[model samples]
Target: MSLPNAVDYSIIICTYNPDRRLLERCLNAVSLLDTAGLVMEVILVDNNSSSALYTLDYVQFFLNAVPHSKLIVAREQGLSYARIAGIEASVGKYILFFDDDNEPDPEYVQVQKRLHAHYPHVAAWGPGNVNVDFIEGVDDKLAAYATEAFQDRHEVQIGYSNQRTWQGCYPFGTGLCIKREYFESYALLAAKGKFSLSDRKGNQLSSGGDVQMVLYCISTGAAAGVAPELKLTHIIPGKRTKIDYLKKLTYGTSVCYSTCLLEIFPDHLATIKSQMISERKFAFKVLKKYLMLFFDPRPKKALKLAAYIGAVAGDYIALNKPVPSGVLWVLKRLKAI
Candidate 1:
């Protein structure tokens, strides 16, 4: 069948000084794909990252022969800025946003292109991960080559998109592709400027801009889904995979939840509360199983536990006040999360 513009897609990696060796490997993965002329180009938006200062000495060295675009030291420091810059510079029929830490499957570009071609009504899509593992320089082909994972019972995966495929809250940010027209069509209502919650100084420790962007697309008339066929091995740092890692990611993600739900699904807080209470009961059943790890695991575990506690509290807080940060302010603002 005819594909979406026969591979007229652009993949962008919003990086802040990605190490040269690692960056090269990531570039090669996408550049060497067998998409004929379909995988048009890649954009490496350097977010003022001086990781490989010498990389600029030879632009072709880092870009590695593909028809690519480069943004040297994006003035804004946040990931959102880098993403916004990439979207602005893209000339392709579809825009794919990949993380610097990700090593995309060879089929990544082709799969997304196929779906967009077939489902002309869909506005956007996300990537799939075979499993969660993070180790540098380790050859991870078996882990990198697939389209499914077996998850623990308690952790739970929410917001399934059978028609969209893949996992994670509807459409995830990593390996996510959005039609540029979504931005152009809804910019007046969608706020196509940088991410919504990102501070001027780039402190994204507690916000979710990617989710905000897609929610905006949904708010408008664009359809979004997941493409399980387009896979990637998300590099979860050792430190980030620990029990504590979940807490921070979840807590930081809380802000994204508030920002997205309020704008996209105003009744999301009620759902979270129902989930927290329901999931907590289920989580408690598994609590006995994980008790050994908590004898005094690490601050990460403590942080994760704190974040869950914060999330349960945050949910109710967000119900009234739409922002996530302080409990007192939430009480004052009448927000739950």
Candidate 2:
């Protein structure tokens, strides 16, 4: 599990039965990175995919084809466990939390290294732009919102900018860069048992692992930044653009967000309680949006509204329930939810 001590950056790509075609594209992009002077290594962590990865001739051949890249199996199935394995096995000062579907620019590694050198206190940083790959035939309205949401980020500027906190910024796991020092010291603690309130589990869209790690790093007084020069392409498949999946993702995201919010800011519970709005107001808003979008006769628009309402309901449910600790934790571990 040990790596050479001289590696400057370790790109850890975690996957669990990922789309073979898209995974190849992601690996191809990594292999093409312009690393003329920088010392980097790509470590692919397999999260116990059901289809025995090693048995696949193409997967083995692909790993061998990529320079300075190797495949390591993380027996655990969760993304957090795979990430923990990668972080422990890596020997680089800087770590990149890359997903199997993300493709980085040619100079992505170099740009991240330069930014790390400039802002040593910033624990985790991401690229300035994350362009989504929306294929044809996807819902046009959903694709538009997805694209807009991806591009709307102000945390890490291109050349020079101050570090931002969780208050205003959140970088997804794709192409996210973190300092190994901070992660080893503080962020790892948040990933303890069942990795509670963490990011996307195998089939569940529930995600907050990245945010949980970021919040932990922020608590340690480390700033989060963004680098515009380090561009990355997020491959969004057609299935993800569907209304059903979007609704599930949004609901899971809200649940994870609310859980992490309580974990990271337990002291703010009283403040949150005081600031809570009436249920009637929430219902009124939902009814208004439903009425406004229902008669529009646009199926996509109706689905979008349904997804939003479902997510809001998930958020309200999570906000009222306290953090999962005693009985709730047991229920979660048993998949009773």
Q: Pick the candidate with the highest lDDT.
A: 2
Model 2 lDDT tens row, 272-292: 566555566655665565566
* lDDT (Cα, tens digit) per residue for candidate 1, span 102-197: 667887777776787787766777754444444533224222211111111111321233321113545667677888777554333445532355
Backbone collision tally, model 1? 17
Model 1 poorest ten-residue lDDT run: 145-154
**Estimated TM-score per prediction?**
0.68, 0.81
TM-score of model 1 (CA atoms): 0.68
> In TM-score terms, which candidate is top?
2
Predictions in order: lDDT: 0.55, 0.67
